[model samples]
Target: MLMGSCKSLKKVNTVSIRTTKPRKISPEAQNLYKRLQETTKKGYAFGHQDATAYGIGWKNDGTLFKTDVHEITGQHPAVHGFDIGHLELEWEYNLDTVPFALIQDQIKKIHQKGGIVTVSWHASNPISGEDSWNRRGKPIKKLLPGRRLHRTYKTWLATIASFFNDIKDDQGRPIPIIFRPFHEMNKPWFWWGKGKCSADEYKMLWRETVDLLTHEFSVDQLLFAYSPDAFDNREAYLEYYPGDDVVDILGMDLYQHWTAKSFSKNLNDGLKVIAQLGKEKQKLYALTESGLEKVRISDWWTKVIDQQLAHSGITWALFWRNARKSHHFVSYPGHKSATDFMHLAQKDYVLFLDDIVPIEVSSEAQ
Candidate 1:
């Protein structure tokens, strides 16, 4: 019992030592952080993962920019999510088969329209040479500074940094990105999950990644978000937290895996935890990834998601990708939940691209 108390006190001191400010951030990124902080007071932004790259049955062939969210409600999501899986291998396309060039183009377009872009990386395992889900061995230790895969991992980060550095605007200014890497670390499926590595190792991995991108590579137009899967308590949620200085956003990825009652209870509970932590740390919070698969519950948007977020103090809520009939999150035009989703979109507290005021930065800053 005494040892546990001592460790807890140490963690508290670590948290207190760090500041909430982003490290070496660009001017536009600073503006974005301020805007998101202020916008949270009014309402939470709505986000969709890979919304413009592809949809239920169509892929953007570099000609038209469309999303199921816009098709249903005539408004785009305020936040847009993209992934850079397989980027470490210097692949031309991500694991989702979306071209890297397309992702960059879409990011520029989103930034031009004053929408937020959040990116996640599902990097392949360096030890086993397998995909991210391969948890055959403890790879985190090997990916660290002195191990055999350390050089390989640094090369991967270099590629990622180059990609981030290339995502600039019309005037050649770096666009701000909410970079979410090693997400859902509380879950066991991924290689970097709870049982795969010790909490200290995870924290080190996060800190080193941020340090490399910000200080080593000079990619500063980023706001790092540390997101874990749902948890029953605050201790479990924060067990793998890197630090406030490294993380700009405190987020959780939740999904309605069971009954709506259970989902609502869990959402409410999780939001309370982050909200309190955000206040203590002076950091932004968000529902980083969430959805009810297939929209099986017709009123899920209005009754479950929106209801939970209604004064939840979250900065944004991002639904997962819209892949196909059996594997989609948001409602399409003719789906059963489409009308209910539209109703949710119309809420005064729900923000879409049309509802948000465009963030303006000086040309000199650019």
Candidate 2:
């Protein structure tokens, strides 16, 4: 399917691809990075978190692949976001109760359909054995090399590595993923967040994790993304950055926590910071996670979200999931914002699944 579709689209130039850890990545991963960079030149892609595993009033029963976005727009998102929160504990199901096996299946399907996949890790707190939000202690240092919890952290990473390695196409090629771990680190809610660990400690944690997965575990089908919560300025956003060589994508997770006006301002400011940094570092960037919960405002999608993202240069903007009645992000069929969302989907600058043309890579490039 990908090969047949590619004949109609321009082929991705694989020469001198600019990805972090280039030597350690697979050919497919390198091509994906190049393809994403090419995509940003045209427009930013639309993404939805956990779109297929479950959605408003429905969950994947290991049978059909469905999403509220698809049900409304008649297409899936260009990018699919999934969380591996509980996979660190060897749990069959993630913290959101989506099965790991099911997540793998959905990832493969999305890739086969020429959509992108980005995975975030809400890893459990190693120090307290609690959820990812547990800030009981400074666990970053302990999770470093030769520390008390280092072995345990390695085991968790091994589990994650295995899961990533298992995401293969029907032809047995590994699917490239934008691996986003310890996201929103500018906030203090998670154990690895700002106040819980020093910036150096956080950088070490990131570098070590990348090293372990790329060199130690030989999991090469990944492009690491560094995302922080909304920040006041560029300096604040880069406080805990590992380095250019360890991060392929620079991202931010800002939502409509308050007024739409404030959300728009923050979105613009955050995108400016990343756009500058991405240009300087030659890396891709995205609004890794976002959206107003419930999408109460009818014109929020077009007036607010799309307006901010116009020529933003970010690769994609992923809305959060549609969990239940009061907790959804995107609109459903009968919701107030559904029509506006449809209009947003129709916009030329916004790339949905149907709008994207798969970039063709020659076997030699792979």
Candidate 3:
């Protein structure tokens, strides 16, 4: 009895270090990180912008003619894309402008269905309520610290933070989001684009925004993506990169700017450049946005996108929206290219709904 009592006292005094305890990364973020690591070992995922909320070829006519991925190919895309352009202006959820409440619901549904969501922002020039390309406003420097719009920018970031915070699954855990802000900055069109601000200024803006969203707001559910337009080489692409620490994903938006024959070559070269950079930096990379607007080529999916992505260690490639019949990316049922797209969807390397690894929904319902 004395020996047993002595052993119990010793057990109470000893403390375990638990060296194998996993870091407290959010479940969604951890799932995405593991999947990205596995995707390089597996294959790339396919995505589409504004896919479920709306589509070009057809709309829900109360029948079997919804042209979103499932309606056309019997499966939803592995990734769903959204944008927050009009939210800064505090507008209701419109076609491109996703209001907070609507987005929250959409995120829940998509997550429940075992899919991923990526978001982009086309923040209007804060000085002018015009489009994103409106250069009539002051330099991007004005939005950084110690400037007139700095306070306004903080309010915008708070709004975005609140929006993301509201995005909770059934268990109330924040959903993992790939937040790509100020995309296509390498192009001199948007207010934050090149020629509008110096590289140092742009980097400051990016870092400051990230610090605000991550540190200040304590939002750990987001994976920041730095995306630029297609550049000739790595030097040009990395010119505006914020830093390795701030960015979790490296992506580039490449559209078919040249003729059909040159489309594959241009996109392939850009992908090669991004792939090399991602490998060197040890970051996940994606074709954040691309599409032959109107998709004139019947085999564009296989010949252009698939051919270029072949053997590339890309995580995902998201095509632009199918807004209207005149300007659409994916083909509708009975469309000339729909058959070719079916082949693309069924390929061993390309992944769609059934092919994607399922994300574990929070078992703790909130």
Give stretches of model 2 more than 4 Å off.
1-23
Cα lDDT tens digits for candidate 1, 112-228:
888999999998988777889999899987877677887888899999999999998989988989999999999999999989988877887786787678777888889888899
Q: Worst 10-residue stretch by lDDT in candidate 1?
A: 1-10
lDDT of 3 by residue, 220-296 (tens): 68777889987888899998886666677889998886696676776788888888877777788899998887788
As for candidate 2, its clashing pairs are none
TM-score of 2: 0.92
For each candidate, C-alpha RMSD in Å?
A: 4.9, 7.8, 10.8
Number of clashing residue pairs, candidate 3: 0
Task: Choose 1 or 2, whichever is better by lDDT.
Answer: 1
lDDT score for candidate 1 against the true structure: 0.86
TM-score of each: 0.92, 0.92, 0.87
Tens digits of per-residue lDDT, candidate 2, 176-275, equal: 9999999998898999998887777787778779878987788988888889999999899998887776778999999898999998999999999999
